[model samples]
Target: MNWKGHITLGIIMGLPFISAPEQIFLLVAGALYPDLDHDVKSEIVQRGLYISGGLILVSILAYLFRPEYFNVGFFIAAILSSLIYVIPYYAEHRGITHTFFSLGVMSIILGYLTFKLSIISPIMASLIALIMVTNNNLLGKSIAISVFAWVLYSMISTSFTTFQGLKFYIIPIAIGYLSHIVGDCITPMGCKALYPSNYTFRKKEGFFGVAIWALLVFYVVKLV
Candidate 1:
């Protein structure tokens, strides 16, 4: 499935957790996260490089002039941006990144990073950066605005400092990540969710797949 389809499916998967705008944005970001492994020929790889370079430049400028704004967090974010570009540059399309293993690992890393760097959620920044680099279209803008609003709310609210740790994010991240895998499973190129086994899993063909997804969405919506 494409980004739009994956994003829609991801939202449905995360419906039960969607009480706030941040969760919605996170869901969207998670859906698109798997495609980070696109080949070098892909526009995503090129954009990743640009985003990485931009972050590095910003980090340097902040260090020189805005020292307070620059810290280990900025350095860590820069390193992450570089990895985001480098890893996808060498990764195979729909390879390890598309697997459930990658989903869990990424979620854990992001969860930890966000908590460890509380002054600035690298998880949100990195994912928002990915959103920007991924599309640069209407969807990206929508997600950005949502994230901006969430940040504004956080700053205005008392919960800013008392932010809960990894546990707060693990569920939504996993839901969104797994939703991406499920979205790909409906495609002709089925997803190998359980990697290292070389087994591909897909939904039934034709209307059956659509029906299953629709039914699931309906059930989830009802519960929500």
Candidate 2:
């Protein structure tokens, strides 16, 4: 999915579980996660690396100057989370970092980092990672009904009102990200859903493409 779709999906999906502030942070982070591995030519890679590096630097400064800036610590946690998911770039396409396994591993790592930084509870961080990862996988499909179902499932499963509860942020973020992928999947160029699973869906030409584009634009605006 395009950037807009990714962000929208993140926000819509994350809305029920997190405060507006937390949702914004997760949407930005999740939207940027996939591009962390982009090469020099890719805008996502360039922006991600710069943003990650900047966040790390800011975190260090915050830690040194004002320990009360505990929130800045989450930025550091985000950088570390990206690093864990982005390393060994070769494993990216091979589905190592893109699967449920990597999702669990990275969530644990992120949860620990967040706990150490005292930014959020370890459990919250873990749930957030899980939501983001699941959404990422769902976004790669082309079927609208399937995409809607995925979003519905995420909303139903992760919906929560308090942080002390199940923490619905992850599920919404996942649905948002997945919605983007589904949008992309219906494009003429298509998307590889079930990558490594040998399943692919092609887009129908004409109005379907136009409709998808419209929906994409709507979500993008919503997310941004």
lDDT on C-alpha atoms for all candidate structures: 0.63, 0.45
TM-score of 2: 0.43
What digit string (tens of lDDT, one per residue) describes model 2 on residues 1-224? 55556555555544543432333444334433443333422343334346667777777788789878847547756677557545524444323333333434444454355346334554455334434333344334322323454455465454334443323344333334444444455656554444446444446532353465456445543231
Worst 10 residues of 1 by lDDT: 156-165
lDDT of 1 by residue, 28-104 (tens): 66677778776533576677678778888888999899998888766776666566557556768887877878788
**Predicted structure 2: lDDT:** 0.45
Clashing residue pairs in all predictions, respectively, total: 0, 7
Off by over 4 Å in 1: 39-41, 50-73, 112-133, 141-163, 204-224
Model 2 spans with C-alpha error above 4 angstroms: 40-88, 91-112, 120-160, 165-177, 193-195, 201-224
RMSD of candidate 2 to true structure, Å: 11.8
The global Cα lDDT (0 to 1) of model 1 is 0.63
Clashing pairs in 2: 9-176, 10-176, 13-172, 14-172, 135-174, 139-178, 139-181
